[model samples]
Target: MMRRLCWLVMILAWSTWGAAAVEREAQRPAALSVYQDLGGTLNVEQVAALPEAVFRELPERRFFHEYSHSAFWLRLQMSAEQREAHRHWLSVGDPRLSDIQVYVPDGNGWQRMQAGAAHPPESWPVVARQPLFRLQATEQVVLIRVVGDSLLVVEPLLRSDGELLAQRRAIAVADGLTLGIVLLVVPLSLVIGFIMRSSLLAAHAAAVLSYILLVCVVNGYLVHWPMLVPWTSYIRAFASLVGFVCFLGYLRVLLQVARLPSLWARLYDGVLAAYLASALWVVFVDHVQGRFLTEWVMRLAAYGLLPLTLLTAWRRGLPLVWMAWAVPLLYLLQFLARYVFQADHLPWQARQESYSISSTLPGVALLTCTLMTELYRSRARQRWAQQERSQRRLEARGRLEAAVARRTEQLRTSLDARGALLARLGQELRGPLLDIIGSARRLVAMSSSDYPQRIERNARSQLELIEDLAALSHRDELPGPSLRAGSLHAFWREMVEEAELLAARQNNRFQWRLGGNVPCEVMADFGHLRRILLNLLGNAAKFTREGSITLGLDCLERDGQRVRLRFSVEDTGIGIHPDDRVRLGQPFVRGRNVEWIDGFGLGLDIVRQLLEGMNSVLHLADDDRPGSRFSFEVCLMLAGVQDVASVEAGA
Candidate 1:
């Protein structure tokens, strides 16, 4: 009897322990699994009809498929205790999912609940940051249908209302802090960039703002706002595309890519353009294809081009280029672990909130540090530039002062030279005036024919001197000669008469020679021609005493209506000295050997000025004869007989 009682007591105790263990197990949340509907045609009835074996148990608490067109069906089997609690809620953690339909068992029917970006929060069965469905007391199974246009990540959880509220409160505080920091940092960066006028800073700020916006979209912060709900579908794609583009721009500026080789700069620009096109494609075209292309392009830029450019910049001696590798390296590790290696079991992958914060915060910090370092370098460069500019200004001031002093000295020397020239000119004029006065007094006392001629010659010399002075003073404003057709023979006869008078004063024999080919009627400026020849013949006559002077004309060439003629004057007088050649053709300047001659040195200067106006040159030839030979060539238009008649008739 004692053995039987011991056996029964042990059985009852073992049964009680097993029942308590069963009760504890019943209170725990149900295990969730997923079914991929490749055709996306499965309804709740069809999914329910399918065998449980067709569904695969999800290995991680949260499942991630970057982007997919296929629909996913999630099945959750609730424990008896969870069903009886009447407070358990089934939550789909991603708010950006395009469509989420939860079918909760109610009595014999299924209570369908809709929530997600597609449905407004007001119509949701239970409004929250993400989709939520209240579990019925008698519910045993919950079916969730999910469809997404962007990155598809689903984390389904079964928890009581109190637990969910507590978890959300914690998330809200963390999100608030993150958003506050973003708001503070974004505007601060912009203000600083504007103040400094730094493109690098502005690009960095743009990148930060865009990336934070992407994070907000991914983490479902924007979808909760009523105004933002309409854009929830496309916001993720837009943010991602814009973020990558902005990041590339930031890198381009940071690496000083414009300063790089043309090939590298072009490559960076192509990548930037591709990213921008992708962004526009997402907004205006098909979002799914756009996002797919964007991902591929972003990967190419971030993984291939970006790293190579960084390496190139580092090799090319860009300062702090190595520091820019931190963000990319961090991103590479995160990408490899999350996507390539399928490290979804990690603690960070439990919630996108944590994952986004973890992935982005470090990159933001690294980029910020790199930018700050660049900012310091930029400030240093500005300082160096300022110092260089100041030094250049001082050098320019010194040069300007020296130039001003040199110009002042030059003006002073010119003024002194002009004063001496004026004194000499006055002395020359006084001698001529005194000669005229003495000749006039002699004519008045004796009434001799020689006194009249002597007085007339002195008066002519004074008049010539005054005329030369006037021509020199108005040399800059002189008009070119007016050309007209006239008889060359008649013109020369008049000129010869004047030349004979000049030659007679010095007892010099004057001879004239004209070429046989010389045209009778030719276009010529008569006034200028007369002045030029008379000056040459008079100079010859003055310099020669009882010496023969010859005036010669030759027709060099004739082409149709134009005739090229050369004129020459030769005198048997003192020739030009070698030392005086360089100093000739200057106003108020006389040859050293000609100081004893009674004349001012304005003849050659006037001849040069007049010839320049006529597009001709005065030439002094080396001669075997005792005197100088002056020659010049001019082209004249041949005129008809009627033209000469008209000219004579007009005269």
Candidate 2:
């Protein structure tokens, strides 16, 4: 394979080298005779009888032969009008062939024919600028009159390849190559695009159409088939313009710029319209070929659109960035070469060999490969994220199962302990109660003064302790799942009322200040929320014995979306120290101040756990609050909620 590739490389290199060599060799000037009859004294028959063999051996065989100079050659001293008419007749064949060197006898010397002149009137009938033509054995020259008798001979102006046939061939070849490449590239682009699942169908359609236009232009111009020139040129130019616009459109779609159209996009559209108008102008306007310069300008403008669109796409972080750059760059090089080289005359093999040997083909392949690689890399990254998500989900499920199992075990143990405690309490209480009641009854029956009163008081005190234990054991079983669509204002109002009651019970003044009516409604378990509020309020009421407490509510908005609801309850009593803050929300944790408080240290821990379960959060409001502000923000469910929309509209 390597060897075969190397051979192909060598063949391409040789072909390119050969084309250059041929061009260099072919462009050299060919030497020939020039003839002109400013004075038309020469006869038509004499001019026509002139040997055409001189034309073929340009710069080689110089002096042309006539049938043995003296034999029947015209010696008529014609007038200038006759000379002009005769020479004009000769000149009618081909302008490029009119100039030729012929031998004209002037005494013993021969002078060459000048361009547009066969000979000088009254002198020699023929002129030879150089004596390269072989003389016949019987040929002889005789002198005529001094100045007027001598025919003028001038050197033939060697015409450069007038038709530029080689150049035309080169151009034709180049054009054919371009068209062939387009044929290959366009179909291949679509095939590869399909394989890659590219959504560039419109752009690809434009490309194929553009390729067809290019093929038409190539056939018309390079092949010298001017009949197809006008229509094909219009189509070619229009198609190319549309192709560029379509490329821009692809970028716009790929980058999702329609979501937020930019200035560049509008301008790109304008430029594309202008390009189409320019193409249309070529069709309607007379002498439109003069506007080929304008077409070039339009092409340049189209070329610039690529980078501008690419820059815009880059700003938007489009996945097609590299493709955007590569696709245009590939075509740009070819476009530049096409115009700059003026390759109208290049041959097909030379042109194909040029582009094929260029880095363009491989560059295109590399570009496609690069895009594929990027897509693959993008997919790989996505796959990795999915795998990570799956792994995380599995880990989260395991932790959740463990937590459920642990909670179940804890509940079972707690239930068993409660049962045993209840059984023991019943046994102890029954004996004591029976004895006390019996004694009290006997005393009441005997009317014993002090014994009856003491027995009744002891029994009453025992009943009070048992009632307190029972009350502690059943503090309103923690809230169940009863979601309520309640207004934030209503919830805050209820929280304030509950906090005030708790504060009054604890001999504390809960300073409840409502900031404003937060119109947002939340969809959440009202019971769980009430428990969260109660824990904070109860903890505050317990800890802050004298000082006031403040609870605040705020709604937050971001990116035109309502996302959060913050609830904070602050205390002015001894603030939680920094060291204990981290430990505050742990189960069974008690700060020094907390240890001195009346109740268990499980309120904040329950609050934290409950909030976590509800996907709400609990945190210290800040590092520098005057006192502890236990705050948490729940993400509001915006679905089926209308307040957020109203608020946003008002804002």
Candidate 3:
């Protein structure tokens, strides 16, 4: 009976122990947060030697994070059973990390193993994008210390050899596709860039090349391509920023941002400058700071404003609006993937297997697609336009020949076949010639108080005007710019006298509003300056009839010795219609407002060419009063009284 009781009690005790152990096993979590961050200051040896009490538990070890110029100590504990029987491999998700120091508990101390981009490639146990480390089976703690430039989101992965191999195969396939696409794009981008022969395409290629290098560096491909190792940080940061700038460039061309408000254009410029500054900082000063600057600030400015800019353009009925919205949408998705969910924290295996998408690779892929689409459409349109232009040219030539034949016939009839010179003059000065013929006939038939003298003087003036026109038509140049010290007061006074005669012929009001501060003399090409004023004033007089014509000269910029003078001619006559504004300066193109006016349509075009020779440009203004207002500036050296006296004596 005593032996039986002992046996039963032993059985009961064994059953109780088994049940308690089962309950404990069931309560333990399958996945544990084994790693702890003892912060940045602790070195591997010191950390390894520290007791468990000094470490705090990292409750959410799964949430990997990024920090600037920071170090982290991570510890993973293994049980005796795990150490004795099973071999484990550790995986790092980000290849951009500069340093990863792993320590294994050996006897009473720690054994340090270095593996990361900072170390040589051959030293690594496994040749992979995400560096893999083989952990020696031990019953003690494993600790890893890490740091990098764009070092973000390191979540240590522990797997069996089989699992690691499987992951390697999977990642190899994923990277093959991603990297393959990137490599493919390089040549295609180059070919497209050459074919397009556009700066936007060149800019796109630059952005793409930067992106390619960035991806290669991120994937630890630099382990093979050692030549690029020195530029990893610069390439990655440059990729993001340049991609943004190029996107803006595309926006500028496609949306024609210059047509947008000046404020909007200035905003684009500011963002571009900001990105360039950040890129420079990354290349020369602080890589970490630049990385964050581009990722957070530059990206926000670019992506946020890009969509709005595109949307505004679309609303204004610009082409490529679909792409404008599409590209931004892709970027928005990427932004959420990177910032909100922190998809970068996902395991490399998961990311490669498409359980999650990385931000950079996919974003670049989308951007490239959109760019190519836009370029393709543009090329197609250009080709179509060329064909249309050719067709129009052929048609225009035929019509021009017909019109010239008809004009020649009309002039021959009007002149009654009176030799070649008279017929030529008839077509050259058709409107003025008709008036001259009528006046001559009237003088012969009727007597007036002073008609004969007036007619003779008018004929002489007309002959002089024809001579001037002939000089302008001599295509060599406006007599090469003879820059010299000349008096503005004298030049304007003489020009005003001629302008009055011109204004008197049409009974138009001529007003000279010279500023009191106008310089007496300045350095300029007197011939060209005089011609410029003549053209502006002449155009004002021709376009105005029984209306006011104003000639104005003023100082725009003044220094002690140098001054910039602005000459303007404003008229109250037939104003230039908005539709004809763009056509005004083209050769042989006439403004609708000047249809009844007598001109060969070469005045404004000749004026533009003349101003260009003198390093100036013709600026047209919105005629708030009535007619067209034309203005231009000339940089002249102010001349003293002695220089004027010498010039007058020489003349």
Candidate 4:
């Protein structure tokens, strides 16, 4: 009886102690003050049950050397004694965490709520820009694990419903402002680029877009786009490369880097290519090696860019370009101090402020200002050129008017001699006609004797070839392309045979091919088509020396009864520039790249006129290589079987 009574007393004493411990936990603050581990590979149970004595022993050092593989763990506590449950939330400092796992208190075990950079925003417990988790103050213990691919840092804070709302409102305002700025600048930059045809402006705009996207990623807003979040690492890695490429391209144009000596320009191009290759590596391969290669390339590029370009442009009086160096300076500084040296020993709040979106602001602003200055300068130059052109036009008009008045006066004075002039002109014309008849009679007399038959044959061929030249010279008065039923392939074959003959005369190699199984017959103008091909081939041969000329014909598109025939003439000669292509079809306007080649530039003009007559259009592609290519497409009605006989006769 005495032993039983002792056991009952021991049980009653243990129950009383347990009740007192529960009461102390209930009295704790509603907000979680501090967490336990900063960096480790610990799981939720390991963290939650960690002895109080163990946490008190370690000093807080947020920066660890093995940050890439380490995980950050935080312990949160709340009283389960509340009269009514209230909404609470957890906030993480860094936005680029690769993984986030939250452990909430359950009946017997912990309940896990998961999120990460790779996860969609909607899947998160609380869908905010950064990782946010909904909570109730009734939970006993909550734990969070943060993982990152690179250096990982953790900053956790518990907030009430009111605090979260206020924070969200502030974030909304900042986001709106940022998006508004981006929206306004993108279109404006595009418009300026279009108006001035400045590649620098276009590149600047692309850089801005890349900058915004990078910001979205580093700030965790990219989670909103579920499809894109999966490529978070690639996107983050590519952002720096894209920005650098665009910025460098802008500088290349604005600073006239291409004006450097050929050897130096080639070196510069090679460096850019290396950087691009590294960037591509990062996108398609391992980010770790890619990041290293890209960083080294950027560092080496800095040597060429900083003193050579930034300082050089400043010396040449570009203030905006000079001011733009701040970005690189800050980036280098941040890299050297925080990333390279592993100097991120400060608390989470300070580190977040040091290397986030706020750091890129000044550089972004400087770039914008520089682009704006360039835009204004472009407009000013355009206006000045316009004024100068107008002044020259007026002067030319005045000179032309004076010349016309003087000529009119001369004509009026010469009216008295006009009758004699006409009589002399008619006499001269009659003499030429009589001479032609006399020469023919003499040639006939000689033909019966010893005149060379070759001379007569050559003379007849020259007359026939001159007939087409005569028709081309009178293109304005001549009729359009005469459409008729003909075997398109046979006609093209004949033209190719003729082109081979022409190319042979010029000692140029000629190649012609028909694409696929082309329709045997097409409703085409044999006469005009022959003229077009002959002109194109003749020009190709004239320009090409010890080189090749290629003629290609293919049916590009087909409808019910009509097919679009695509034709191309590519020649191993000096290629055309994009700028010169605009005036290519104008009579007597040769491409600047044509150099010393002898051409009145009438060949392409005639071809364009003929194609237009056939209701076709001409298209200039990138269209340039070690040589040049001129291409056109024409829609023609397909010929039926009955047209074959007529086609044979026409050919």
Candidate 5:
């Protein structure tokens, strides 16, 4: 019986303790339920529970209590001045709930006031169809009413309208996207701009990007919690000031003003720096008041800089003169609307400020790019035109110089030829007359047949030399190149025969080699070709005294067309020096080694002219042994049927 009684007692004790703990937990105070702009529904019982000090501090809090049927709501009369002030306040920034409070007048005294705070399940009573509410004596509202020290404090009430909430979220998203695009475009644009060496465009793009980034940051923080709050407002104001100063600095560097007045430049830079330093202080320090109002001062200074840049560019017309006006003009309209019309709307929405500035900047940049391209093209055209004019002038001078040189050479050649001709004529007349006189004397003294023979041989040799001179004179005065068909192989054989005859006079062997499978017909000035070949053969024979001279001919086919016929004259003689090679082709310039030999230097000069007239080339072939081999190549045109017939008849 004792053991069973002990178990029963323990169970009762445990049950009693559990019940006491549950009752204690139930007696604890409920958590604070804070509300902003409660619409005429706050309970007076809950307000009466609040402490007097909490009631006095209510005005500092931001919560509004609405009274639906109060005389203050229905019969509130505002003067024109008061209404204008209210409207101006609304235009400046978003309106905030100042405070929410409850108060009960002390019975019959009104000097002593009792404040109330709203609590859970407490509703303010309605009397005479009006919601009776009392204003607190302070700015802070008592959101929580604790029975004792054990009550829990709740989070502050978040005050926001539906439109503001949505706009804040949108601004955040837009700022993120803008930052992303800037990150991508900024680095790439900077690299490309640096590579291209376009400092103005680079600096402009960077400054614009930085400005955009600043706007995004400011707008994002602003649309959320920090915009209207006094501390954050001051910080943002200062940040904007810094951005403005940075923009002006970038503009100054990009414009590259070297000759601005020293006093003005230093003053402008100093002011910008001062504003920027003030902005930095605001960012770091708290409780820097008047942030929203001070924004105006910075904006005024910022806008003033634009006009200064414009006046400077206008006066100087320095680098990118159009940019000074273009950028400022686009910004000017929007700036005026902000200060004059007080358009402090957000940047993303299509309100007055946003829409105007949004379209203006891109348009200005594109226009500047277009103008720059046009200027570059215009400068290029001008340079090209000038170069063309200069080239034409140089060509005219060159032609005049060539004509003068040709006339002077011709006059010199005429004088030399005349002198030689006169000397030859004197010799010819003296010899012939002496011979005829001797023949007559012989005849008078019973002369023999030998004297007559001697006279005939001398007369024949003199006649042959005169005929050669006459042919040379005629060749020198030949007509322009007239194309005609002729036998290529037959012409070669004639030159070879003439060369062999000349070689026989010098007791030197002569050899000829000819190669071509075609009909060996060509259209050319035959007289010029004949003279060129004769000169080549004569030079070969005149130089080679003991060894053999060889003449070679071949017709070449290029690209399925008869292009050229080549002639080579090789002689076993003292080879020409490398330095004298070009000199041999000049008129009146005999090779040094050939000065002891016979003949004037006119042969090769005349040969070069004839070859040039036929559009041919003469080259000294590189035999490089103990002898010289000079070769000639001429382009040949196809012969017509009538030309072939004439060529065959001439052959």
Candidate 6:
């Protein structure tokens, strides 16, 4: 009976203490109803003077108004005992709010404390990423006003100092990590874009940069960097606009709109234009309306247009296009969940500012992977193309070698036949030609008739033609010039006589001109030189009828042991047609105008070949005197020691 009484006494004491504790907890301040200043014109004094029935209560502690033009007012009612028991703080969870003012009752009037993006962090009652204010011990009624252009989520929290400090620290850590990620991803995207020279990568980099800027502005990091604080509003607006534009541009490039069907391509272009126009509106027009337009446009692109475009590109053989859009789509969903739907109850909803900023990483990583894969595929294609080209070239070379071998064998056989035919012709024709020439000479000696001389000259010309044909056939086998010391004066006199005789055949007059500085003696192959001049003079003489032919020699330059001489043969006859000049040096090719009077057209070609062997080129100079002139320059060693020594001394 004594033990039972003791237990009952203990249980009774515990029950009384628990009941009192429950009553005390129920009395503690729990919920504070929020109110809106719909007109946004109410001052702290007016709001304080208004009755409690004037303001409408919020459904919860949180409110979201995208681009709110009016201010929101929150009235927290607390007893002096409750305020003293808990050293409370009024924390506005949004950092992007443009203006925040807290009114704490101070004796007879209100002591106002300010914190928001509008006021720099230095002036804040508690310096943190979000607006925080400490409530006074005696304050019973606190008025909080919030205003901004950004999407407003006013989550006013009444917490103790330790809870506020812990929240601030968590926010700081999240923001720091976000900043670190942005810093890492942005430059990396830029570098990869630049290195790869990829339009897709470049567009992605621009999107990342612009989106990060928007994230920084929205997260209220501008206050940390004071230089950016003044242009906070402008930065936020422009960053949002540019971010949307960049994302659309990235999608366009990734989809390769040019390769899409015409209708889809045009639709993509139209949407892109709309985005660009919205960005312009944000800059030059009202930002609030412009941002509203931009948001809708972004939603259309991100949710509707981009997916369709990706689908179109995928069907058209771009299999990886969907993979590229996956991360961005995920980011978009996250954005919708957090800002649009206000689903703060989700697991990932904590530290949403950090989540929004750091979400760019997955997209960047996806882009990097896509670019690397593309690079690898490109290298593979290049290697395959190189191998294919090499294989084709090898096959072509083998065919060419076989063709060349067959052609060489045929040429060898044909050359043997040509040699036999030439030998037979030489044996058969030379005897008759010799007989005809001997008879003509005898007839010429027997009678003073011009016909015998004509016959003899014709026979000699025929013999010369035959010799030119033989030379043309064996040109490649010909030896170099056999240089010998010779007198240039004597050689010139002999050439002049021959030229005059040849010219007289066509009733043409021949003239010779020698420069004053023509060398007296030179070391040259007179045989080849004589043949060259004979061919040119013969051509001139043969083409001209009752016209004049002139052969000129000039000393172009005189060095110590070498004399460069210019030789020219000019004819005042039917000049060579421009169209026929190009064919003049080809074997069996003659000027079109001179076709009626020519033998086999082997003279000029033979002249060209001989000049080539002697390191000279034949040039046809344009003459304004109704004639064509063929000129060539040749360098010969001065044979006379006295002449060379004189030239050296003069030099």
Candidate 6 lDDT at 530 equals 82
**What is the overall TM-score of model 3 with all chains considered together?**
0.49
- Segments of candidate 2 deviating more than 4 angstroms: 1-14, 19-188, 200-209, 212-216, 220-238, 250-260, 287-375, 378-382, 385-389, 392-651
C-alpha lDDT values of all predictions? 0.74, 0.50, 0.66, 0.65, 0.51, 0.73
RMSD of candidate 2 to the truth, in angstroms, is 25.1
Q: Model 4 misses residue 556 by how many Å? A: 88
Model 3 stretches astray by more than 4 angstroms: 1-39, 49-63, 79-85, 120-128, 198-205, 226-231, 238-241, 261-265, 279-290, 311-321, 332-383, 386-651
List candidate 1 stretches off by more than 4 Å: 1-28, 59-61, 84-86, 272-290, 314-358, 389-651
Residues 463-576, candidate 4, lDDT per residue (tens digit)?
433444444433332356667887777677666866787778767888887898578778877776776777777877887777899999988888779888888888886566
For model 3, how does the per-residue alpha-carbon lDDT over 1-651 read when each residue is reduced to its tens digit?
Answer: 336535543554454444334323221112323334435676767666677666556554443554466676666766666555454777644676777787777777777777666776666677556777787765456777877766455666666666655556555555455555556665666677677665555555566566555556565676666555556666666666656766667667645677777887998888888888877887788876776675665566656877787778778776554555666676686677766877865433233322122333554455466456757778898999999999999999999999999999997665454434444664477567557756876776677565554464456455544544544444323445777777777777777877898788789988988886788878787666666777777777777789988898888878898888888888887878899887878867887756777787877877887788878898889646668788898887888889988987998
- lDDT for model 6, please: 0.73
Give me the displacement of residue 251 in model 2, in angstroms. Answer: 5.3
lDDT by residue for model 6 (226-258), tens? 666757777776777677778777777877876
Clashes of each: 0, 40, 1, 0, 16, 0
Question: What's the lDDT of the predicted structure labeled candidate 4?
Answer: 0.65
Clashing pairs in 4: none
RMSD of each: 23.7, 25.1, 29.6, 28.1, 20.1, 16.7
TM-score of each: 0.53, 0.34, 0.49, 0.49, 0.44, 0.53
Q: Write the per-residue lDDT of candidate 5 for residues 407-434, one digit (tens) a residue.
A: 9999879867875785577566667656
What is candidate 2's CA lDDT for residue 437? 71
Better of 2 and 5 by TM-score: 5
lDDT value, residue 59 of candidate 4: 30
